[model samples]
Target: MKALCRDCFWTGDEQPRRCPSCGSMRVVRHEELGVLGIAHLDCDAFYASVEKRDRPELRDVPLIVGGGVRGVVTTCCYIARMSGVRSAMPMFRARKLCPQATILKPDFQKYRTESRRIFDKVRDLTPLVQGLSLDEAWMDLSGTERLHGAPPAVTLARLQADIEADVGITVSIGLAPNKFLAKIASDLDKPRGFSVIGAAEATAFLATRPVGILPGVGPVMVQSLEKSGYRTVGDIARADLRDLADRFGQHGLHLHRLANGQDSRSVNPNEARKTISAETTFNEDLNRAEDLEDQLWPLCEKVARQLRAEGIAGRVAHLKLRRPDFQIVTRRRTLPVPTQTAKTLFAVARELLAAEPKGQPYRLIGAGLSDFVDGQEAGADFFAEGERRALKGEKAVDILRAKFGKGAVVTGRALKKE
Candidate 1:
C-alpha cells in the first residue's frame, strides 16, 4: 500500500498529497511499511497527559507532575515544554522556567491503572510486547498479520488511534526492521507521530547523524570517539572491525554494529526487570544512626513487597545514600542466595548502611534489589534454610496486608518513622 491515513485508516497503491478517502493530511508513506514488524511505542508526556485527561480544565494549561521543591520534574506537558521546562529538571529550575505552570505530586497508582488499560489493548494484538518503561515498549508483530488481517503498520496505526480514543492519551510509534532503528524512528517525530526506517536505507540514513545517536554513546563516549577522529556514525560504520576492537575493545565493535543498523536483541516478553527499589528524601538531613535505620526499614518493606508481588527475587541487596551536597553513594552486596523476604532485604541493607561513616548526615536513603531470579527458587531444595523461613514469615505478613490494608501490619522501626 502507498500510504496510511492515521485518522480514517485508508490504504492505497499511490501516495497522495492528502489521504484520498478522508482528505486529511495526516498521511504516512514508506516503502517497507507492509513488511516490517518490530516496533517501538512511546506514550507522549505520559504523566502530564494523564493529569490533563482527568482534569479537563488543564487541557490547554501547562502541567508538571513531580514532587516537592527539592525534587526533580518527573514529567511536564508539551505546553510546559514550550516554556523550557523538561523532565528531570530541578523543581526550582522548572518553576523559574514556567512560573505559571501547575505542579502536582506524582500519582503513580493512577498512572499504573492507565498504563495497564493501555497495554491490555496492545496485548490483544500480540503478546510479544516488551516494556522499556511504564510509557515505552518494544513490540514484535512479525506473525500477527494472519490474526489482524492487515499489515503491522496498519495494525499499529489503528492501535495508536485506539489508544487516543479509548485511553484518552497519545502515543508515538516507530516501525522498522530491528529494535535499535525502531527506537530511533519513534523519536524522529513527537507527540503523536508514526515514522518508519527500512533496512535498505538504514546505513545511508544514519551516516550523517552524530555518534551520540547510537545507544550507550553518552557525553564521555562522544568525547572519546571525537578525539579518536570518529565524529559521525558514518565514521564508525566505515571503520575496520580490527581497528575498532583494538582501539576500544568489545564496546567499539558493538558501536560499529549499531552504527550499521544491526541490533540482535529480540522483543522479549519475559525480559526481567533490572532492579526494584524505593527511596525517600528527608525533611531534614539525618545524622543519627537510629533515625537513619528508621528511614531504611520502611523502604526495605516497600521493595520486598514489590519483589514478592512480581514473583521475583534478587541475588544482591543495594543501599543508597545521598549527602546534603548531592554526592550519591551506593553499596551493594552479593547475597548467599536470592531472596524476596523483607527480613533478608533489611538485614543485608542494614549492614551496608551501618558501614557508612558514623554520624554522617544524609539527605536521602533507599534500599533496592537486583540480579533477579524466579521467586519459585525459594521453594527449591537447595535454597538456604534461613531465607526459606524468612520468605514464609513475609508471606504471612503479605497475607495480612492483602486482607486488611498495607497499614494492617508494620515493623516497630517503621512505626518510629510514623
Candidate 2:
C-alpha cells in the first residue's frame, strides 16, 4: 500500500489529497509505507489534555496546567498555545498572553495513571515498546503483520483509535524506516495526526530542513555550524566527512550521518534510565536546613513515586544543592540495598544535607535515585525487619494515594504550614 487514510484506514496504491474511499483529507502516502514498521507515538498536549478530560467544561476553553505565578508552565492546551503561551514559559507571561486561560496546578499522579493506561494499550500491540516519557513512546512492529492479520500501519491506526476510545486522550503517530526519521515524522503533524517517512525520500526530505532539526544540534551547535559555513542539513550532507570530523570531532561525524538520513539506533525496550529525579527552584533562597528539608521531602516522594510507577528501585540516593551564586554542589550516597520507598530516599537525602556546611544558603535543593534494578530486587534480605515494615507501610500508603487522590495520604514531612 502506498497510501492510507488516517481517518478511515483505507489503503490504495495511488496518491491523493483525500482518501478515495472515505474522503478524508488526512491521507498519508509514501513509497515505503507498507514496508516501514518503526513507529513513534506522542500524546497531544498530554497534561492539558488529561486535565480537560477530567473536567469536560475545559475542553473548549484555553487551559494551562502548571505551578503558581512564580513557577513555569508545564503545558497548555492548543487554545492557549495559539495565544503565545507555551510549556516552560513563566506562568506570569503565559497569563499575560492568554488571560482568559483557566490555570490549574499539575496533578502528576493523575497524569501518570492515564499514561500507564495508554502505555498498556501500546504494549498489547507489541512487546518492543520503548517508553520515552509519561506521554511518548517508540514501538517496533517489525514482524507482527501475521499475528495481527494487518500491516503495521493499520495496526497503528487501530491503536490510535483505541487510545482515544479507552484512554480519553488523543495521540499522533509517525511511521518510518528508522527511529530518527520516525521521530521527525511524528512532529510533522500533531494532535491526532498520522505521518509516514520512507527510505527513498528521507535524504531529500531532510535537505531543506535546518540543521537544528537534527537531534543534539542545539542553538550553540547551530551557531557554530553556521559560522563554519554549514547552515543546513544539505550543507552537512555534502561536506567532506573527514573535514567535518576534524573540526567538530565525533559529533560532526554523527551529524553528517544523520544529515544523510542514516541512524542505526534500534528501539530497545530494555534501555536503562540513567536516573529518576525531581527538583524545584525555590521562590526564595532557603538558609536553614529545616526549610530545605521541608522542600526536599516532596521531591523525594515524587522520585519514589516515579520509581514505583516504572517498577524499578535505585541503589544510590543523590542530593543536589545550588548556591545563590549558581554554584552547584552534588552529593551521592550508595545505599546498602536498592529502595523505591520515599521514606528511605528522604532519610538518605536528609543525612546528606545535614553533612553539608551549616548556614550556607541554597537557592535550590533536589533529590534523586539512580542505578536502577527491578523493584523485586530491592529491599531484599539485606534490609532489616524495621526497614521492611516501613516499606510495607509506605506501599500501603501508595495504594491509598492511588485509590483516592495524591492528597489521600500525606506524610508529616510533606505537610506545609499555612
Candidate 3:
C-alpha cells in the first residue's frame, strides 16, 4: 500500500491515521497511486463557489445560482444541499426548501473567465487533458515521472494546493486505471477531496454501488433496471451479458462492460467537439418570431465566437425550439461546406426557423453547429468560386473581430429588424 498526505505531500509505505510530518489526518491511500495516471478533476459546487469567493457575505449563507421564480436551479452550495436543494430542481421548490438561500443569476462571463484560468493550470500538469465540460476534465498523467520528479499522486496534491492558494477555489480529484472509475471516485468525497480506486478492488467496489451511480444511467433506466431486478452494479455484473443485451438492446452491452470495469476507451486528444450550443429560458414564452430572432442573433454570434475561439467549424447547423409545454422540436441542415461563420449558421438556422409553425409560443429557442472539422479546411466550394471568396471575406471579418471587439464587425443581416 502507498499513502500520501494531501497537506504536506508526505509519502509512506503504509496507511496511517495521520501524517508523520504534518500531523494531519487528510491522508489518501491507494494500492496503485504511483502507477495509475488517469484522473478526473471536478470543481466543487463550481458556480456557487465562485459566487461565495467573490462575495464574502455569502460564505456562511446558503447560495443558489439560477433565474427567476419559474426557472430551475443551475447549482447550489453544499450548505443548501443539506436542505435538499439540488441542481435542475425548479426554483420554486428550491426556494421553498431553503428560503434563506440567496438566489443569484448565472454570471456566464465571469464563470468562463475563471474556467479558462483553471483549464490553463490543468494543462500545465499534462497535455493529455480532455475537457469534459467547463468545470470538469480528464487528465492522463502517465510517463511523466522523470520530468516532474514525483509520481502523479504527489503532483495532483500539489495541484490541489495551488488551486486553493491561487484561485480561491477547491477541486476534487479521483485517480483510477480508467475514466469510468476515475469519474466515479471523484464524487465520493467532494470539496477538496482526493480519492482513488485501484484495479484490484474495482469490481468489488462497484458491486456494492447502485446502477444509477453509473454514468448515463438516468432515472428512467434505473426504474427499468430495478423492475428487472438489476438494482445494483452487482446485479449487472452477475447477469449474463447475452441476457442483458437481449433485454436492453445496444445499451445492455455497455452496462455489462462498465459493471466489470472493462472500459478500453482511450483518452483521445482530438476529441471532436460534438456540439456548440446555448439556450435561454425566458421569464415568459414569446410568440412572435421577430422577438425570437432578436434573441437568436446574439446566440448565433455566441456559438460562432466559441467555434472561432476553438479554431473549429461545422458542416451541420441545427435549430432547437422548446415549447412551454416542454415539447422539443429540432431541425438540422448539412451545409455544402463546413463553416465557423456566424453568417452561415444564422442563415441556415433562420431558414429552419421559417419552416416551423410561427403561431405557437415558445419558451426556449437554441441554435447549434456540429459535424465538426478544422475551420481552415472549410469554405472551399468545388463549383462556386464566388462563395469561396465570400467565405474568405467572412474569415477576415472574424479575424478583425478577434483583434478588435465583437461589435467591431456586425453583419447586415443581423442589423435587419425582423
Query: For candidate 1, lDDT tens digit of each residue in 260-356?
Result: 9999999999998888998887767899988888888888888988888889889889999999898899999998888888788889988888899
The lDDT values for all models are 0.90, 0.89, 0.87
TM for every model, in the order presented, reads: 0.93, 0.88, 0.90
Q: Could you tell me which residue pairs clash in candidate 2?
A: none
lDDT of 3 by residue, 225-310 (tens): 99999999989989998889889988988998899886777777678778999776767888887878877877887887788778
**Model 1 lowest lDDT segment of ten:** 377-386
**Candidate numbers, best TM-score first, in rank order:** 1, 3, 2
Assess candidate 2 and give its TM-score to the true structure: 0.88
Number of clashing pairs per prediction, in order: 0, 0, 0
Model 3: CA > 4 A from native? 382-418
Comparison by TM-score, 1 against 3, better one: 1
